[model samples]
Target chain A: MAETRQTELAHADSRESVTPLGPVRRSRDLRVYLVVLGGVMMLADLSFIFWVAPTDSILGDIQRVFYFHVPIAVMSFLAFFVVFVASIVYLVTRSPAWDRLAQASAEVGVVFVTLALITGVIWARPIWGVWWTWEPRLTTTLILWLIYVAYLMVRAYAANPNQGARYSAVVGIVGFVDVPIVYYSVIWWRSIHPSPVVGPLAQANALEGTMAAVLLFSFITFLILFVFLVAQRMALRETEDRLGGIKSAMRRRAESVF
Target chain B: MVLVWKDILLEVRSRELVISVLVFGLLVAVVFNFALDVTPQRVTAIAPGILWVAFAFAATMAMSRAFVREREQGGLEGLLLSPVSRDAIFLGKALTNLLFMLLVEMVLLPVFAVLFGFSAMSFTLIGTIVLATLGFSLVGTLFSAIAAQTRSREIMLPVLFFPVILPVIIGAVEASTRAIGGETTVGLGRWLPLLAVFDALFLVICPWVFSFVVEE
Candidate 1:
């Protein structure tokens, strides 16, 4: 299975050499587009959040953090969802690429989750008067973060690459499935986190017009950033794999010479 | 059934796994006693948490030991070489782990009651124990198999086990606290169903995943 994949990857690599404007150029173009689009959207989101959106009658300026905070939280979920799907595929096919993708998405998801937790704490300080609360959403997010952290540790500490991929894929899928249960348990157990502000049951015009638009804009921006980071991370993993192959080849050659 | 009996009989003969786990569980309860200054009034309030924590840790110890004998003695290969389906192997190992955990719980519960100065041996509490143990052993056994094959099995099992089983711990702790507090129907009503849901879900999922894991 691995040999076939390596040969297929090598074939694709050779094909990239033959056509100057093939997948390589297209991927490069996509990367550029993602970066540019994400940056522009972020700037627009910042402006709308800081200057355009009406200040909350209750939370004042601090509520602006929700624009970025909620979106980062959403994007983190998206990243982990990708990891979950990729992990299932990897388990079924035993393909190295899917494992790489799962690892990349999980790493990126952890970063975004960290940012979400930090922003959440910052937002909570003036509003809730505490830097931390055992509220449902925050607690669930913390557990989610821990779950992925464990996922990454499994990948890092496995006995071999094959073992790592196989084990971590299982962890990834299991961890993702556990997320909803964690959320449900926390919510049912106790809930102090703010209820949804923009959903159907939200207060009358709680997030009207500019606030909703800014939130939407921020979500799109973070989505783009998520894609860009996962792509960069996956490419780095591929390079590492290629370098590992070369190092093993050199060791084999040295042993043959001896 | 044969495989399950084989594991149980083997455990009964050696007696090492249950002895160590029971002792460890007692020590945990004792440590918790010294660690927390429990007022008489608060004993019932905090007893459930302490008991469940002890059980959770002891279960980890037992689960980590689940496949060690098999892996070391090449008994797992012998089992695999049999005509038994992979699901049977998983069921057998899970049942053995469950039994080991329950044996420790049997001793741990009475010790916990005496040490903490409370007794709530209601059927609801017993039912909760069974359900929680089922959930723990179900997933814990599978992770034990996967971790036993790794470079650092001891550290890997808890790292994988705890995070995955967080819901179980939460559900069990809540339900047991209620059951012990004497709110029989209401207490069990909320948390017991959670345990049932988790156990049922993992009951179907873990064995399927175990087959894939042990195949390699």
Candidate 2:
């Protein structure tokens, strides 16, 4: 009974250290509201896509993927930007909260990027007649995917959590710096030798009223979804970190007892 | 300056760093020579690509040694303990990596010229190699330092290095193509500047990050 109570106190202490200082009760309510808002918004956004928004005259129904695809791409970039900023903060502050935030954002960013790539390929097959191309946007997105995947790998392979946080923070910054250059290099390459096959008319033709509205709405909806996912990931990461701490602390105590 | 000299002097004595990199670079060239089956007709067109692939991979090996050797010898902590700033240490290691890569290039360029029938003496091509190598060295040094502290480092270095350093590769290959094909310097202008820009950008960025990787 004494040991069990001690373990419980230890657990509570670790949890308090890891827990964010906001109204803890309100956060649960906030999470619940976020899910409900996100679900309803996502459903409305889908309806706006399939039924309300007019299809492209040139590309037709397959172009509907644009609504979700573009926003996810934007969110992935947003996620990574959070990572970049959070990483800088983590380095400066050495705070586990910021590290968890950076890690969570990176993971969500990677997943969003994967979704964007899949939707891109799905759209590309019928429109571009290939599963993939070296289009500037797509190419840079691919590079973005690789860099963060490497970031995740570093985190996984690290010798310890503190080391993982430090190394990945470095990678997070470097990877962001690389993304724009990758885009520029691809753009320059394409400019030098114009690809023979003409690309989709999406860039050349601007979206009209309803199409624009739907795209904007979906982007907002996805942003909410992205924030929700990241918050959940961060909470889980904090719990895992707290548990690791308690385990090690218990181990040290056990060693002392012997 | 002393850091560079220390590394170079050590490299000259053991001769292992440059020699191993040279062998690996030569092997990449030779293997690609077979792999691409570079017929005379196809050689010039593909020459830039092959040369760069060799250079990049070879430099990766050199970069891997930059810190890994120091680490294994237990000299890294001593270097860290020295009074020099972290940036200086990074610059010294990067400069050493740059020189090692250039040495390999000086040897490999002639071989590439012979095999692919391009004149190695083209100033434009030589300029591209120098500029591109600058970018590669800066980024590679920092990554090598980062990877040195990790597991499966050889693999980690490339995974982290390649995607980031790709612009240099593209710019180098494009510029080299124009140079080796005997094209005018006008064609060389864009790609070289792109490389210079990348070098300048990362020159500031890499050393800053190196501080983080080595921070105790």
Best by TM-score: 2
Give the range of the ten consecutive residues with the poorest summed lDDT in model 2 chain A. Answer: A16-25
Q: Could you tell me the lDDT of residue B159 within candidate 2?
A: 96
For model 2, the stretches where C-alpha displacement exceeds 4 angstroms are: A1-8, A11-16, A20-26, A200-204
Enumerate the chain B TM-scores of all models.
0.96, 0.96
With a 3 Å backbone cut-off (N, CA, C), the pairs that clash in candidate 2 are: none
Candidates' C-alpha lDDT: 0.82, 0.88
- What is the Å distance of residue A182 in model 2 from its true position? 1.3
lDDT of 2 at B11: 87
lDDT of 2 by residue, A5-97 (tens): 687656656654456446445666787888999999999999999999997888899989989889999999999999999999999999888
**Per-residue lDDT of candidate 2, residues B1-216 (tens digit):** 999999989989999878888788788888888898988887778889999999999989889988998889988899899999999999999999999899989998998788678888988888999999999999999988888889999899999999999999999999988887775555477888889999999999888888989877
Relative to the real complex, the DockQ score for model 2 comes to 0.85
